[model samples]
Target: MTRALVIVDIQNDYFPGGAFPLVEPEAAAANAAEVLGAFRAAGEPVVHIQHVSADPEATFMRRGSHGDEIHELVAPAAGEIVLQKAHPNSFLGTHLESTLRDLGADEVVVLGMMSSMCVDATVRAASDLGFDVTVVHDACAAPDLEFGGTSIPGGAVHAAFMAALSDSYATVVPAARLAQTH
Candidate 1:
């Protein structure tokens, strides 16, 4: 099966000293970089999805800002595709679906920042679009969230989202498993 690696929103804003930092962001980026290397070595298609917020009131990921750029460790190569998006779903308001289609990608290996939001949205959307998806759990990160005065740790939030997606929206695996697959 033809497969593509979709690296979503591994931007500066999610890292340390950026606008919005996620839990274990550096470690997650390293994991993603490792997976990216595997895909590159295997001659697979790799697409980088960048989130550029259009809202003027957005605190992070403001368009044209330094934090809006993808992190250097996992930045796209010259021939690789870089897609800018304004929504949680990468396929929405972007050429992600068409690009995948053109690359003959029936399966996608996904990883990146904000697991509870972008990763969750993209995996479900990919499933709805009829593409098989494999989400690298360790390669994704999320920040702690608060709801009704209760604080949810980032790790818990990440695990919950991965668990929800597993066996339903996508097969959630680790970076090592991804290497094995390649």
Candidate 2:
């Protein structure tokens, strides 16, 4: 079965010095680049998913803005599939499902920004769409949050999301293992 790596929402705004940056964005980008390199070296397919915020009030990823573009560290190669999405779920309101179907992919390994949001959304959507989804835990991150006067660490949210996706929604895996897979 053909396998594809879905790098979702590694956009400029999610990185440092952007409108809204996630925790450890640079490291996530670097890990994703490593994974992408491994996939390319093995002649595997990669789909770069971008999230464009339809609302200008959105802190980051506003459509038609530079922040919505994919990060420079991991630029899309010529002929690489680029799916633009308006929602947190890449498969919703986008051609992502059709693209994967066209590519004849059976498995999808997901890695990218906003671990608790977009990453989680994509994983669930992929699973519901019947693809064998494996989410790269270390290659995903989310912004810190505050609840009831307490600050929630990004790492905690990231871990929680990974845990949630592990058994039912999708298989949670590390980038190293993903690199070893087809």
Clashing pairs in 1: none
Worst 10 residues of 1 by lDDT: 173-182
Tens digits of lDDT, candidate 2, 97-145: 8888888998898999889888988899899889998888888889998
lDDT of 2 at 94: 87
Q: After superposition, which runs of candidate 2 have C-alpha atoms over 4 Å from their true positions?
A: none
How high is the CA lDDT of each candidate model? 0.95, 0.88
lDDT of candidate 1 over 1-182, digit per residue (tens): 99999999999999889999999999999999999999999999999999999888999999989999999989899899999999999999999999999999999999998999999999999999999999999999999999999999999999999999995889888998888876
Extract clashing residue pairs from model 2.
none
Q: Which candidate tops lDDT?
A: 1
Model 1 TM-score, 2 decimals? 0.98
Give stretches of model 1 more than 4 Å off.
none
Best by TM-score: 1
